[model samples]
Target: MKAIQISQFGSNDVLTYTELVKPQLNPGEVLVKNRAAGVNPIDWKTCSGGGAAPFIGDLPFIPGWEFAGTIEAVADDVEEFKQGDEVFGFIRFPERAGCFAEYIAAPADQISLRPDGLSAEAAAGLGLAGLTAWQALFDKGNLQASQQVVILAGAGGVGHLAVQLAKWMGARVVATASTENHEFLKELGADLVVDYKNESILDHVNNVDLVIDGVGGEVGIDALNCVKPGGTLVTLPSVTKDEVIAAGKAMKVKVEPIRAEPNCDQLDRLAGLYADRKLVLQIADTIPLEDIGKAFDASRTGKVKGKLILTL
Candidate 1:
């Protein structure tokens, strides 16, 4: 099987496309022939000796956390999935799950079946960002219907999804993006769009019930003022979480930093939403598996509006 592996942490130069032995399945795992893999900031960051680099164990590691594929084989204990089942998952996040390869040994309990209508590219991109948005809004923020919510970096991979999810949950959605993406966000169900480049986000709206802070640090600190008293702010960037949290504490606002976890049940529900056409996963670009450097460079810019996928 061909895979993107890093023998040492450095830059894009370290990501190598080479042939390797297939992975062995565990007791409750399924072997999947991957069709697509999602490229995220964490993928590049880890390869550059940051992000989840420390948690990924030793060198010569595979660095992908989300994928969509078909089951080639299954462990005897895995009764939920069979050979030839189309599946997708966000698994072993902030660690190594090896989704970049053509084959993956994924835990059966951590994956969900891909619904009939969801494309493999869409399913591949849906895992990490989708789960991040879902968990940040519903799980951590406890956002209620009819309440207002503000999402920072609204045109981003997670932000765009958060806008739609918040709207679907019956919340009044306010998103922050560049002027060019304002209309795009509105189409995604954001009721209001604030231009972060030319205008202040605080100037447009305030006293929101929840704020999903995708852009952390000073930007996150500034957005803390937008949350209503007793409302929650869910911060997603781990590198700047402490600064945002301390700022939240000084302002008497509650801040929750989140790392998206694997929940097969929630992913299944998200898949149902896709199958029903209630949810949509935006794809920024799709690159071949051998062109990981291009995808990595694009994601590193932090300007890609939607998800970047690698086709196998």
Candidate 2:
């Protein structure tokens, strides 16, 4: 099968589209004929030798985390799916990654049926971002109805979905995005969209029950000020563990770092939400595997209205 692998980590130019033998399945794994692959910032970060995982591979390494595809075969122990089943999931991250290829052997436990009525492109967009948003809101934040939640980077891959899920949970959603996404976010059930560029988000929001922080930087620290006392602050790509702990303790706040895990049950629930029109996964653009570099660059602009997908 044709796969994009990096012989060395440096820049996007290092990602080479080359031919390699098709991977075979092991126990508890399934061979998927990938239909679409999701391009994440982590993929680029890993390619640039800046990710959390140690560079273990000699040269060529496949870098992709999630995919939506059809099952070509399954291991003996697999009982939940069969050949030809349409599925989607986040493959093991920062360890074994091959979703950028046309075929991959992934653990069956990680796979889930794609959201009903969603095309491969849409399903591909949901794997990481959807899980992060859903888990943060329900699993970590414990958000409830009548709560007020603020979603930083509201139009981003995870932020957009978080805004919708928080709204579905009956929370009043306040979001921050560029002026361009004001209407887009409002349509996604965000009750309030603040322009982070021109206005002061701190001036507009206070006593928020939960703050979902995707843009983790100095801004993440500032986000704590918006949350109500006892409110939880959830962040991805957190800078320092000790700093977060000390800040949370000083402010009498709860701070949680989010690293999204593969959960078929949560994916299934999100699928149902998509089928019911209660949620939507927006795709910013779809690129072929050959153009993976462009996709990676696009994701870092901090202006994407949605997720970027790579068509296998």
Candidate number with greatest TM-score: 1
lDDT of 2 by residue, 57-136 (tens): 55568888889999999999899889999999986733445689999898899889874598899898898889999999
- C-alpha RMSD for every candidate: 1.2, 1.7
Error of 2 at 35 (Å): 0.7
Best by lDDT: 1
Instruction: Report the Cα lDDT for candidate 1.
Output: 0.91
List ranges where model 2 is wrong by over 4 Å.
55-59, 93-96, 239-245
Q: Please, what is the TM-score per model?
A: 0.98, 0.95
Q: Against the true structure, candidate 2 has what lDDT? A: 0.86
> Clashes in model 1: which pairs?
none
